[model samples]
Target: MTVLTIIADIRIKPDEVEPVLASYRNLIPQVLPEPGCLQYDLHQDNEDPAHLLFFENWESRELWLDHMKTDHLAAHQAATDDKIESLTIYEMTKL
Candidate 1:
């Protein structure tokens, strides 16, 4: 199995940050048990509270892609729609 690591650095609108984070926090429990999902975590920048980081681990790239298409993920995306200023996604594998 391939170990996939995804890091997403997201910037949320000033006033929307807290709500966005709360939304993500609330959604994590629902997301972590999905097929192929190994881990899911959210982090906030020490200096910049508006900046958020998401760490996701999956069994494989295809499984991660499948997770992206789930209804829960879609709902999460819709909830944060347009509230994000920027988003960067990175994928990594074991050496």
Candidate 2:
């Protein structure tokens, strides 16, 4: 099975960057323990502190899909709802 990679671009209200970061930080531990998750890391742009990016690698598309239903993911989304200005997720595979 082919591995899946995802890049998530997240923009938040400038004032809420810290809160959103906390939410993501809490989520990482949960995601890391899940099956098929190879890596899940978060990054912030030096120029734009409110802009966050997630670099993720998974064992398969199916496993990644399963992750979408996880409670931690849902909670993170809910907690950051008001703080989030925009979100874009790109799913990719090595060519």
Candidate 3:
């Protein structure tokens, strides 16, 4: 098994930050039940309100890929397409 963490430095338009965050909040319930998904969370930066971060855990890389291909993920991508500034992904394994 593997653990994957995706840190997305999403940049929302000054006025659209709240709505963009709300959209991400609404996706939690929909994304948590995906096969192999163990945990999902969202975080905001204290210094930079426009930056958003995502923490996700999955059983394996393959499972994570599957989750990425789901309709829910597609919607997520569409919603944040141009809104995101940069995204960084890290894959880890238990010692």
Query: By summed lDDT, which 10 consecutive residues of candidate 2 come out lowest?
Result: 71-80
Clashing pairs for predicted structure model 1, backbone only: none
**Using TM-score as the measure, what is the rank order of every candidate, best first?**
2, 1, 3
Residue-level lDDT of model 3, residues 1-95, one tens digit each, is 44765545466666667777877888899989888888888888898888777777787788889988888778977986676656666565555
RMSD of each: 1.0, 0.8, 2.0
Could you give candidate 2's per-residue lDDT for residues 40-59 as a string of tens digits?
99999999999999999999
Among these predictions, the greatest lDDT belongs to 2
Off by over 4 Å in 1: none
Ranking 1 against 3 by lDDT, winner: 1
User: If ranked by lDDT, best first, what sequence of candidates would result?
Assistant: 2, 1, 3
- Clash count for candidate 3 is 0
Least well predicted 10-residue stretch by lDDT in candidate 3: 1-10
The lDDT per prediction is 0.89, 0.94, 0.76
TM-score, prediction 2: 0.96
Superposed model 3: Cα runs more than 4 Å off: none
